[model samples]
Target: MKKLDVTYSANIGSYLGVPIILEDNTMFGTLCAIDPSPHKFDKKDLELMQTLANFIANAIELGQAYEIILAEEQRVKKELELAKKVQTSVLSEPVQLEKINIQAYYQSSESLSGDMYSWFEISPNKFGVILIDVMGHGVSAALISMSIRSLLKGLITSISEPIEVIKELNHHIFSLFNSTHQSTYATAVYMVIDTELKTIEYVNAGHPSGLLFLDQKTMKRMDEGSIILGIFPNLKVDKQLIHYNEPSTIMLYTDGLTELINPVINDAIHTVENIIIGEPDNLQLIEEIKKEFVNGKTLKDDICLITVNVE
Candidate 1:
């Protein structure tokens, strides 16, 4: 203090003080006591003063740490809220086309999700559909999914071929997320449905095999495709074509739905086929499947389901 200068020392007869220092050796302030008359402080007096100073330093440090934690928590909460809003906006609603009905259901975990799904009508009876699941959760994964989302309509409409569209998407993903130390990737399935031709050309890139239901039974399993996107410099894509003369439904989903029933995706596809068998209405089928999913177990990850019902 300015009052503790040499000029003022003559007025203070006796004084003792200890600097309040934190664990990081940052000096906070001084703990001091002064007497008007001359006096001598003993060892006990000095020890007591030192203890009080230490206590004050610890309290101040703890209070500061608590405030910092609170601030960080608030910042993260706001960011997640913003991310969730952006995520919901990008996710498209279920659409009904000229020859096919497209239905989708999504469930988010505690935080943000990487699961994304959408379908765009290329023409009256032709549509391009896609479902993607990035590797992880939270802001990073959600951002990657959203970035891919922005490219969906353009890629689907322009390319119009499953293999070419997925290959292009893989190139984009690889270019965006490849780092020297780490890389991010996502599993995806892209389909071009031509109701006039009664054909569905699809490519599954390191994703769960899709289920195709016809005549109340599982007819085809979509297992063709290559590795996930964003990992390697080059990606190999295999497109599979299926013909459905009669009315049929195709189920495309992320890994979250499989995690509850079967860790194996093919097995999960078979299990869900049972639910879609009796329900002919695409909308009712979607609701029934959603009910089946939440019946007993809690969802561990984000679940996204897209069903294409060709009429």
Candidate 2:
């Protein structure tokens, strides 16, 4: 008798009613009665065949499931990368103004960031600057920040007052997030400086208080607006007015700069002012501060600084 194992045999036997198998001990075909049918195999033999087929089917199904999971993961990763690039591009670069000198820097903590800063020339002399940080970081936060930027850009040309700019923006953000159960918020500081009048008007919305250096001797912290955007409906922020005459520097920044635990805010501010007082150049001032407090270290949070020298 020849060996007749399912693993070895490529063809089925003509006599299907009998169970044919080869024992491992010897290469001899053995026959056993699987179903009591004289004509052909019965339901019992058919069931055994179906059981084996099911095992192969299960293996194929598992392999397909694993492939689907891998593909979904890869798709999500690609989408995140694209979102990061779009968010970074939406934040404006160092824009040159005709009358005013502008030096600005933005460092994203992650591949995607919530922090956004934009400056646009409303006219030759009149310009608009916005510094904003969404509630969190990553894709969701980056999307919120991008939405805020779009809303601002559309409304900025029509709105002249900083408070009005914030009010309208707050309404748009809150309304958009209300239905989706997506509670998104932002902290922002906006300013419009009139170079001819030498007056700076700003509105702050739950962001870090900005710095106004008056001849290096007098330093005033500006904190005007009350609530964060998207928290309240029809939010109203008071616009604080400051007059900058002579050689004065207005420092608009995010909280990531001051919240450092090691150097501390007081020590950091001292280090920045010491270099900036004598050196009037905007580029030189930021370089000195970055070297001293930041130490060329990679930032954990997004850091944005906009220094405007009133000329």
Quick one: best TM-score, which candidate? 1
lDDT (tens digit, per residue) of candidate 1 on 119-211: 888887789999999988877888888889999999898778888888888888887856556789999988888889888889999998887
Model 2's lDDT to the true fold?
Answer: 0.72
Residue-by-residue lDDT tens digits, candidate 2, 88-180: 777666644454677877777777888888877665577778888888777778777877888777677678679899988788778877988
Relative to the true structure, candidate 1 reaches a TM of: 0.82
lDDT of 2 at 148: 82
TM-score of each: 0.82, 0.71
By lDDT, the best candidate is 1
